[model samples]
Target: MDSATHQSLLNAARQVFEAKGFTRTTIADITREAGIGRATFYVYFASKEEVFAAPAHQVRDQLVAAQ
Candidate 1:
């Protein structure tokens, strides 16, 4: 997928994961919020757990950099 699409998925995943938490948020939730398909979500991330990690790590990196 392209960078724009990937970032959209990541942003949508972050929203859903934050609201619903990792275990409760499904592929459907991410894709629906992203306005993409299930296959599209899988193209970028292997699973919900993987999706959760990226944003959390990004936040951590930003926080550390600010310190």
Candidate 2:
């Protein structure tokens, strides 16, 4: 996996989701925010939902570790 690209996408997705909210955000919005092609997004994530889950999972893992 291209970690740099993946992190870029994650950061972009978070920004977009925050700005537009989940229902209003689209894969195109995320890719646009990431300054990458839509196809590149699919190469890293199957769907917007999957990408959205990445940060959530990270937070969950951190909470668990802190417990």
- Highest lDDT among the candidates is held by which one? 2
What lDDT score is found at residue 28 in candidate 2?
Answer: 96
State the lDDT of candidate 1 residue by residue for 1-67, as single tens digits: 4598899999999999889988899999999999999997888999888888888999999999999
Span of 10 residues, lowest total lDDT, candidate 1: 1-10
- Which residue ranges in model 1 land beyond 4 Å of their true spot? none
The local distance difference test score of model 1 is 0.90
Task: Provide C-alpha RMSD values for all models, in order.
Answer: 1.4, 1.1
Q: TM per model?
A: 0.90, 0.91
